[model samples]
Target: MNASLKLLPLAIGAALAVLPAAYAAQDNVQTLSNFKTTGNTKPAETVPQTGTRADALRENLKAIKLPPGFKIELYAVVPEARAMTIEPSTGVVFVGTRKDRVWQVTDRTKRRVADDVVQFASSVTFKVPNAVCFSPDGVLYIVEQNRVLAFPAAQFFGEGGPDVAAAVVVPQGKLIPTQFESFNHGARYCRVGPDKKLYIALGQPWNVPPKDKLAELDKNGLAGIIRMDQNGKNREVYAHGVRNSVGLDFNPKDKSLWFTDNQVDGMGDDIPPGELNHATKAGANYGFPWYGGGHVRTEEYKDQTPPAGVVFPMVEYAAHAADLGMSFYTGKMFPEKYQGGIFDAEHGSWNRTKPIGARIMFTPVKDDGSVGETEVFAEGWLTPNGEYMGRPVDVQQLQDGSLLVSDDYAGAIYRISYAK
Candidate 1:
């Protein structure tokens, strides 16, 4: 039986070509093939890289305040840009949006600015495809609201027709149970860890889940970070009790996992601070409902005795800041002090009476792997009138040591570079 199974692939390939009419009628066999994707007939759409809209976004940068010799410019005009993953080998950037489209931005002439921006893998209908990450081997993993797809050699396939080769890592409705899915807090994030395991952040679909759903949420891998083999096998919870973590990366020095947690709201704005947590080992719990953020207790689980050994944030951000994607500085273009630090984007506050945190923050890392206090690296997205000119979603470092910041509100990506 084992030997027959080994030969089944060859037999199936042969059968599909030479089999009788009745055998060819088996549509289910073709549908079940790993190569299948929900293909569309529509041609790929290219976003205009230079236009009035792009100029307006660039002009808005004049209002931005940066340090000494740093400057920001419009890199590309990607609508609703949310999360970004870059292929180091090709320098191609894959950006995900809250909507269905994933964009491919390329600088064909080796210029720092992108030459073209177009929809990637338009054949596949991605639902809230807001998070994307690439493995060192250049495999692109797009984490949608309810599915995860891996495109082998996406840097090349993305340039071809809409029918790019896609492998289902986690099929639709299988990453999480159907009943637990919700649109709110549904934008997922993932990374290929140093161990080569795929780590994904799953947000619980509530301000705070009721006590009844706690057990099931924990059991089903919600409200936590889960890790699995690259092919999506042997999945297990790596961390628990996270409310909603939008950004995560590994510390190259020590290989520890660090993630940003968006805290609960409606608690009068300043009690529970946002979080940048360090997970040194597996099964660590970042306090959530029991403690909203930091040590502040939530109204829902205020009276309950919290679990022992709950890990807290390594650095606490201001409340309601909406901290999102983060990346460790592993580049040489930046000065000595900026090396090994972290750059995190604050998407800004939605409900605060006085809005804050539409900026990029920097946290210095000591040689021992401990973190220092975070400071505003760049600002002016939040105007004095308490309005957001642009909301930065994620920060990605390019191979040249420049940084790319995606703003969903501005529907653009900006490049930040330094000059001595």
Candidate 2:
């Protein structure tokens, strides 16, 4: 009687009858040069040789359990890093690379430390840069693919260093213009919000569904969440249907924003499940392609009934589980049940059929913030039969409280702590 609960009312009546014809054939907005950036054309590669299978990468990460002293470590390796940022005046730790490069580890003995790496910024033919924030005046924001550059913490610790060509700084309404074949979704993960505004996660030119006709079922043409003004002017639309949110954050207790989407593949290996939104206002739509997560909905927006203002998903993760970077631990050195919680990374799934998120999930937040059901704060890099070596993505927090994690599939950064 539980064959997956008898296919839940036929997947909720076929996602409410094709959500308004996928929003009346979306309204034309496809143009990001058709999403194509091979990200680093492959060349400088080395750093995936963990012996004894590296303790099986910690055996499915022991299903993570934490809460009694808290402890975890692997910390510094910096191979393909991914997305990360931390400067607090000089503990360093830049990181950003799908290959175009940008690193600067440091800590060379400031004590509560662990870095040494250094590349600073290089080549740049637009590999998957992703994101790398900073700007409390030290500058350093970057989010390649569609562009959004900046750099000047003395040009990334100068002495004639990190000048990927210097003179970089694109803050004039944050350049947004790519979308050719569809699915450019390249707003890439960005951050600087606490109202300092500069958020950005865009994704959705087309992972599927978009033959054009005003973008087929258009809800503003291709996914959402944009916000600007770190000089990028008042460009608004803080939330709306999102289909590739590469991890975003802001809940330092109510600053409220939180993100982590990444679902929408031939729709089969278990329907939909990768989301964790929570914008609240400023645009709020959260339904992507139609509707996903519990209320399900999305056969191209099935017969449209999910509107009353559009916004759903406070938690849901499993389907593709490619979550990506997100942080919000606040820190005290752990145990207080890992304060505030919400540390996502899951870069696992490659269009699924096995592999489910690369591991590191936490959830649990409520004092009015909501979300309260995820767990497995860390798990073996994949292999209950799937076989993956490392993926994780982003999750920072280290003024000493510990927790760094990057792992562009084993380029390494990990440093989760809690020790007695």
Candidate 3:
């Protein structure tokens, strides 16, 4: 063996010895590495995952305000439910979470309600697998902090506990540069775009990335939505200057990209508004730290010149609403006015002095692709007294033309439909 080859085992041993200590020195206190599948999660032990608190759920659902003929009901109980995707062929709803597990919810009886809510790949290890999406051909892609995994023929996989095998498309360490990895804003949301590319949101670790690290961050696809071939090659940033966007969907009519951005905070109660943004062309720039939410500039970069052609938001919501997962309405069950509309989830506020969001909002999209007025579609998760009964995280349309909304706080998903 060559001299260098002879040193391989020693080097390997040294690296093995340094592994745990290196992990210990990592700075992100809430990093995904902290949550192991073994002992850390402490998943809730209860059926209907929301438990038997029927009265509270009923009251919360009752408090919801919707148009006539629209109603809301519990769909399933999924812990820390964040982003959602449905397998059209099998009618399986795959729910992601901010926890250690991904859930597979099935309506085995075709009752339009999920009677079986079970953990997906319960046998596999996962850390903050909060984003799940499906390809038109039934391939499932799961995005976690710093990793992307693919499960072929995912919708047909047997529904057994802790099951399913995943082929790593983007390994954990490869997605984010080591220097940019942090606990904050690491949960990724993904979808197979019209171009048949896998697109994912790679949130920056900070509310605003430091000036010194911006170049490295951008080069690594941090702080933006990135797209690549279905097999994860040729990763490229599609949008930039995005502080953090949890919700995004492609317009079916025109195949444009639209996303909701959670804006900068510490700007007082209502200075910067949360955003509903549209991306018309490739490599679009949505102003972030320079232009905090929509047009409001961040105090840190108040005087700096922003990018010349930064794209602004289509609509702005009240500041700190925590706008999250969204999907364009393609269902026919709702009124004709809602076809091709947008249904978005507001995950509610965490830092504001006055809490807001915690509801589902809708925006109408006209044939000309102009976004009409925005309105509250369903609420009651947060009460008049400011108590949070639930926090809506994502919105996905079911095969039946209804909608499924996920809530992390209440550990449940709700189905919304129209009767008239």
Judging by lDDT against the true structure, name the best candidate: 1
What TM-score, over all chains together, does every model reach? 0.92, 0.32, 0.88
Q: Whole-model Cα lDDT per candidate?
A: 0.85, 0.64, 0.78
lDDT of 1 by residue, 1-420 (tens): 333234335534543443333422322223222345434567899999877998899899999999888999989999999999999698999999989899999999877999999999876667899889988777788998877767767888778767665555666677888788898889999999999889999998899899999998998779999998777778999999999999999999999999999999899868689999999999988888899999999999989988889998989999999999999999998888789999999999988878889999999988787888899989999899998899999999999999999999999999999999
Which window of ten consecutive residues has the lowest lDDT sum in model 1?
23-32
Ranking by TM-score: 1, 3, 2
> Lowest summed-lDDT stretch of 10 residues in model 3?
27-36
lDDT of candidate 3 over 1-420, digit per residue (tens): 433234334433433343344432342211222222332243323246344654466557878888899999877767777899998776889889877778888888878877767777654557778889987777778888866766655655535233343455665567788667677887889888998888898888887667888878777778788998766668899998888888899999889899888888788888799999888888878987798887888888888888889998889998999999999999999999889999999999988887998999999998887889999999888888898999999999998999999998987888999987
Each prediction's RMSD over C-alphas, in Å, is 5.2, 20.9, 7.6
For model 1, the superposed segments whose C-alpha errors exceed 4 Å read 1-41
**Tens digit per residue, CA lDDT, model 2, 329-411:** 98888877768878898888777676677878899888798877888777767767887777888989888778888887756
In angstroms, the error of model 1 at 391 is 0.2
TM for candidate 2 is 0.32
As for lDDT, the candidate ahead, 2 or 3, is 3
User: What does the lDDT come to for candidate 3?
Assistant: 0.78
Ranking by lDDT: 1, 3, 2
